[model samples]
Target: MIPYTLPEVLRLVWSLVWQQIVQHAQVVAWSLFRRHHQAVAQVYHYKRRLALNTS
Candidate 1:
């Protein structure tokens, strides 16, 4: 087994942790964007229906 120095070990761990954080963040952002898009579409449809009813 290759012995890693302290800094090297820390760097390896940090990279792994950072990758996990970035992946989690991407997933969260995508979900939020999808939800917001759905909400906007719903609102647009509701407004269109209201306009049709009024006119």
Candidate 2:
């Protein structure tokens, strides 16, 4: 039987952690982007409604 060295195990763990970090970052970025888009759309809609009321 063969055994993995300590360095090999550490490397594997590091790779998994890095992958998780990248995935979480992408999720957070998309969430923020979506929130920003929704906020902008709401502002535009509010402004349009206000203008219509004034006219």
Candidate 3:
């Protein structure tokens, strides 16, 4: 087996760490977007229901 030098090992580790960070950020962003969409939808539905009831 070929031995990896220190720089190569560090580079590999850094890449893996960066990939994980990017993945986590993506997950967080999507979750926040979904939550906001759901909240907006709920508010819209509530308003529609209220308007219908009062009519």
Query: TM-score for each prediction?
Result: 0.55, 0.59, 0.60
What is the Cα-based TM-score of model 1?
A: 0.55
* lDDT tens digits by residue: candidate 1, 1-55: 8899999988998888765555888999999999999999999999999999999
- Which clashing pairs does model 3 show? none
Q: Model 3 over residues 1-55: C-alpha lDDT tens digits?
A: 8999999999998888765555888999999999999999999999999999999
* Model 2 TM-score on a 0 to 1 scale: 0.59
Q: After superposition, how far is residue 39 of candidate 3 from its true place, in Å?
A: 0.3
Clashing pairs in 1: none
Off by over 4 Å in 1: 1-22
Q: In model 1, what is the error at residue 52, expressed in angstroms? A: 0.9
Give the C-alpha lDDT of model 3: 0.92
Model 2 regions more than 4 Å off: 1-22
* Order of models, best TM-score first: 3, 2, 1
For model 2, residues 1-55, the per-residue Cα lDDT tens digits are 6899999989998888765555888999999999999999999999999999999
